[model samples]
Target: MLRVAIQVKELISSNVTSALDSMSSSAKMLHQLQREIEEAIIALEGERTKTERNLKRLKATLTQNEMREADWGDKAKAAMDHDREDLARQALMAREDCREAIASGKDDIAKAKADLKEIDEAVKELEAKREETREQAKAQSAADADKSGCSDAGASTAEKRLNRVSQMEKRTEFATEDTASARTNASVDREIDEMRRASTVDAELAALKGGAKKAPAKRARKKA
Candidate 1:
């Protein structure tokens, strides 16, 4: 029974940890989703702008085509008035081409409008989801922060360890400086001692020379 209880407790703990992890991951996903949605909206808006421009151009071209058809109609009437049936037939045939162009332009306009509407609807849906995800991510973040005191605790431990390492480095540097100072002092003392010994030897040599010269003078006087 005790073993079974221990196993159950471990399982519960594992489940709790897993749930927290899942929540954290979900929060991260929300951030990615928001960015993706925003980018998608931007792209969609750009495409919409392009569509509007294309539609405008198409309408302008359609107007030109209609004017062309009218011009052909006038030409046909003038040719018929002059009794030129061949010229009138050619003008009518050209007008048919202009009419076809106008029809195609109208179709393009319709498609563009439909496409823009769909894009607008998609943008709205994405924006709504973006807001929803943002709120959920915020709530999840707060909850995760509360539960994961481990992060803060770990940072604190790292800070203290760094401080300790810094102190040890300082101590080592100070010890090295002190040792260098002691070595320098010892070297200076040795040099001073050597200088003193050289001075003493010179003084002894001067005294010995004086004693020898005086002894010679005394011997000469005694001989006299």
Candidate 2:
């Protein structure tokens, strides 16, 4: 039973370490860890029950031994009353054996009680650690969700900006082309310059969107 308790302690420690290092797969890891802790608790409880039953049996045996010791003592007195020294000696020896047996039985009961205590302590520790791990998993899940939300919001903003730049570029092209036939050389040069400026703005917006698309991947790698 003590060995089982030690094994459970080690399992809990290992589970805690795993929980701490978990990231995207934390939910799955925590679920498995929870099952392990519960199994350990069940095992500890089984040991506790067996120890309790053994302790009860030991106490019952000790009680019977005490009664037998008393009976032997009475028999010895009766033999002395009948003037039989040999029978009295035999009765006294039987009572001594019962006394020895009672001492041994008491020791066994004490050891069983200690074993039960240790098992109970192990169960409590496992339960507490399980709860702590659950809390950690919840916090991790919330953090992951928050991060995903931010990433999505950034991507949405980037897409909207890109769309607005595309629309503006299209409008500028259509307007310039419509007025092309009526424009002089100077006017045409100004239109070309305007188109160049619009292209630069479009390129900048595209770069922003590209960076936004890569941001989530970078965060994921860092988390890993």
Candidate 3:
């Protein structure tokens, strides 16, 4: 039973290895796709970095514009107090232009940030996929090697055990047959002994009867 169990375990492992190997081609394809995705994501990230830098510059410019607008507002108020309407109008226009620049910069920054986040996530996902595929391949290779080795070892062990069991069974059967044959010979010998004893007793009884009959005849003849 122990040997049989080992053989069964080996067979199962071998089959599992075969099944996994069957998927090797598919796994390679997945690995390739994962690598491609990673490369593409890397390239996209490089581009995204440039965009992010541009967005950063734009944001800095926007901040500077806001400060300039505040300065312009103060100047415009002073101009109004001094009764210079043309100077006040020019200052207000410059402030409005700064506001528009700040708004445009904010929009660009928001879009760049969103794109960067998406690219980062894609890069992370691709890395995960690549790692997963590599681990799977390694595990499968190890399993296949182990299964092949175990199957060979277990098969040999099981065959030896089976042969031993068959030998034992044959020996047992021979012993039983021999014992039965011995019993048969013993019974035949006992029957022959009984027959010989019965024959001896019958011969003795016949001789005695013959002697008595002869004596009775002789006595009759003498009396006559």
Candidate 4:
């Protein structure tokens, strides 16, 4: 079986390659999106600035119109008290016109403020999205790099094989030594057995001789 190190290294390399590819794609998309976001934000800001200025101008105009309306009312009141009916009517008409202008300006200001708030919120959301994309891309790139730099298992497997062969050689040497010792002990055992057999035969022969001598002695005693 192949060593785990080799297989794992291959897997890591392949996975890292895939991860890097994905990261690259993500980065490209992020770049494009960031550009779009920036453009949109710029355009929105420009429009917002224009709208704010318009709103401010309208507000100032509205204030001036209100002041004019108040002046006209005062004039109308004075004229009415002085018995100038035509003059009072003209002032009252002018005041009504100013009121209408002020109302229109107020509406414009409100619309402009609403548009500015919406643009500001949109810009903030885009920024947040851009930040998230950046972080994700960074993490992916780091992971990919780590995977690509992984080591292969062939070297370790070769080392292990060498170690196993060395151990086997040592075991074989021990077995050879054991076999030689057993052979030496067997030769010594055989020699001791042969010597014991010869001693037994000699002892039997001596016993026979003694029996013979004793038989002769008994016969002599009977004769006497």
Best by lDDT: 2
Give the winner by lDDT: 2 or 3.
Answer: 2
Measured by TM-score, the strongest candidate is 2
For each candidate in turn, the TM-score is: 0.54, 0.56, 0.46, 0.49
Q: What is the C-alpha lDDT of each candidate?
A: 0.61, 0.66, 0.55, 0.57
Question: Per-residue CA lDDT of candidate 1, range 1-224, in tens?
Answer: 12222322332233222323443334554555455556656767777798889889988998999999899878876665555656766776677678768888899999888877876776676677557656776886777676735465654644553343223112223224577678769988878865764464345434444554576679899999
The superposed Cα distance between candidate 1 and the true structure at residue 83, in angstroms, equals 2.6
Candidate 4, position 85, lDDT: 59
* Local lDDT at 121 for model 3: 62
- Give candidate 3 misplaced runs (Cα > 4 Å): 1-28, 136-224
Candidate 2 lDDT over 38-148, as tens digits, reads 777888888888888888899999999999999987887666555565676677667767877898898998889888877877788888888876777677667666664
Give me the overall lDDT of model 1.
0.61
Lowest summed lDDT window (length 10), candidate 4: 1-10
Model 3, position 183, has a per-residue lDDT of: 78
RMSD per model, one decimal: 46.8, 44.2, 56.7, 58.4
